[model samples]
Target: MTNDIIPVILWCVPRSVSTATERAFMGKEGCRCWHEPLGDPFYFSSKRQSLRYSEEECKASGNWDKDIVDVMQTLLDPEANNVGTDKKGPVKYVFVKDMAQYIIPRQTLEKIHKGQGSQCYRTDGETCGTSRCTGVDSEGEIIENPTVIPTALMRRFKHTFLVRTPTKAVPSYYKCCQDKMAGFEFFDGAEAGFEELRILYKWISNPRSTFNTDKEDGPGAVSFPGKAQKQPLPPPLIDASVLLANPASTIKHICDQTGIPFDPAMLSWDAKPQAEFAKWGAYHQGAENSTGFKCEDDGAAKTNGEEAKIAKLPQEVRNTIERNMEPYEWLVKRQTTFA
Candidate 1:
């Protein structure tokens, strides 16, 4: 049952054009698209209460855990849904674009896959007699993975990750929450102030990370002093800003690590339809009346004298974006070095 499912893992910070990028891949040839919104895609909604199987369903017959295992198998393989969606070409590659939230904390995910994938993490209160959450122990205090779905079953799936810039991500996120590009109420008070949001910007901009690990995000993120720590904090998941800033260098970075050819189209939507502008309305509620970066769509427009607002941001946050971007600036300067 192993189909052509190519797990196109979208490792991205929120507001990093993930939805747009996914739309591009789905529009490609022979790729099946499934949205792991929050986590579960296809059947279960987020309001999903939990395991609803009776004792017989759990033990004697096909158990909840076993059932999920089968479903994961189907998802990893090819599906009719992915075939010929692209009128321009024949379908062969099946793409599954989702966030790394599926594998929060990393170690837990690795443990699950160690054993055919466990359904313990996917338990609902009814089945496991507990809340619909998987407790994760990190830094000491235990917290729910927040986004852990049917993990044991889908643990082994692999996917490609897309990363982007932090500074741009901040404004974009603000726009989304305000409803310019497609945001949710959860974003309410998302950017109460520029300084506060700047710290958040650095958190999501870790570049090396892309999934929400039990709300494991959000701490006052100030810039690294560049003062090499006694041991240098582990680099972020993947320096997304690094990629967006230097396409040529990004090309080599991807090849050096994954051996995949860099398709220029990966950076920008080539077939972006004019009507797609309206699609923003579907995801964002407040976008109907925003100016430039305030809206989810067409945020590329520069603001009139927004520089006056820079000082409004906390010095720590302002410094993070600037200092972090310096490496990219350096790379651009050495253009002759990039492939």
Candidate 2:
């Protein structure tokens, strides 16, 4: 509404509360949800022309090219895709949210601010657009719709990036594969650096995801919040053992980073519905099995309290999340308050 043209780009790893975030915005009136630019019911549709995509496509689009974002947006343009153009609801905001962007590269993202023409296209093969590109599966069989034109579709609207915890990220990515939504070979031959992802995840969820946008650590690299803070490197960012050893300090640390006001929502006694397209299905029971915030001041390795059920996940889960959330860390921190 501010004429500022804030093309909000909502970003998240699969099953990382993306839909929940989208729903929250939708509820605010002025927003229209676009599901994941590439997810569900339609991506796997047996029909050739359902005009749908799943997060998996975005994941496998080769490199996490910044142009991929622009191209994807271009493909979603109502002028190109013909569906999103006439959309209307309480919110006129355009959400270019999808879990797949996490697997892409920094240069590709840097290109996002530049505009189209930077995108790499399917030059030799038939492209996906305007009755031109061929709509084929990985094996080359034509599907119902034509090729998916990332460049042509997404160029029509504004963009933003929403991000979250890395611990939740890998779990969700794995779950997407388990549910037949994606493939185990998705990351095959790709630049999947787990240690790097762990750092990126924590950084992005700090509400400053974009502060260091268009930047990357060369190698053997680590980024701390400030120049003065000095702590030896280890499993946990700020001396995990030391911080975890003190719960109160841990909570304060979390507060310092995320800027998300601690809330009673973390201590809810209500049951939570099964997460849609969630990788943490093992933790799911049903909507009736809702749980509430159980934040406590217990002295433990996870310094954060009961409100940190999410902030303080098991180490193994946290490790998995760090490994997978290499991409899109900026958005992760930018919207740290939603949960």
Candidate 3:
């Protein structure tokens, strides 16, 4: 919570090798790494936005009561215990890796603005703002829609992004869905997440204009409680391909930008299952099994197999990739590059 404690978040697209990126920072001195803390509220909360799981499945997953504010408070608390690891002390940096879509899904934002009420459907089939709900504030006032985290809370952290080519990311994500998420065979195009990342990037660049504007002037604009300082420089963006091709230089460049000292040890670590990633099942298997950054297609068979998988993608999946390319390229052009 002190001004000296640096909080950094790596907002990423799914299957962008983001978990591996988090792994690079795991054992660094004075660092605390959190694996998708916001994911609990986004996917399992009573007011959850995702329909990927059934009501029973969501409740069975864990307690779905915590909201965005609770999650942020925990991350920013200097005395809080670490989620997955026992490393604890005076923290110098708090690093989080999470999918941007989990923070604020594009469709959920659209639905809320269209005056359809909260998209939070409870397990009992009740909407969030109804009489039986807990959507009111402590003073018994209707709580405003939490479509996005408040601008003030967002500014607490130094934000960065991790992106992958849609052609590659889309197919990779589809495979994860098939392999990990039971009964979810087809990819949910909404979860491709480029649009949410674009919105967040623009918001972070100029939050005052994006969040403080009149409802008629900006899409999904809301009155936030605090002023958002205009960022003097754009936050760093890391392309997954670039990081894989040059792990040391790319990670060092990121460290320089984010105020962390570059360490050679970040490039390699022992292959061990991370306790934090266990909650998400096998979604992070590659990262858990990796000792260091390596080309995903290290073998000829892998190269050919990945190509064949991409070629056989369903039409909807292909369309999702096409839709995301514009945003993906926009992010790529702005990514931090190393010689």
Top candidate on TM-score is 3
How do the residues 201-264 of candidate 2 rate in per-residue lDDT, one tens digit apiece? 3333222232222133223222211111111111122221222234344433332332223332
The CA lDDT of each predicted structure is: 0.36, 0.33, 0.69
Which scores higher on TM-score, 1 or 3?
3
List model 3 lDDT by residue over 134-207, tens digit each. Answer: 33345543233233565456655678888998988898888887785434565677677786676566555442
How well does each candidate superpose onto the true structure, as a TM-score?
0.44, 0.35, 0.77
> Which residue window of length 10 is worst by lDDT in model 2?
226-235
Model 3 deviation from the true structure expressed as Cα RMSD, one decimal place:
8.3
Candidate 2 ranges with C-alpha deviation above 4 Å = 1-6, 38-91, 100-159, 179-339
Among these predictions, the greatest lDDT belongs to 3
| lDDT (Cα, 0-100) at 311 in candidate 2 | 49
Ranking by TM-score: 3, 1, 2
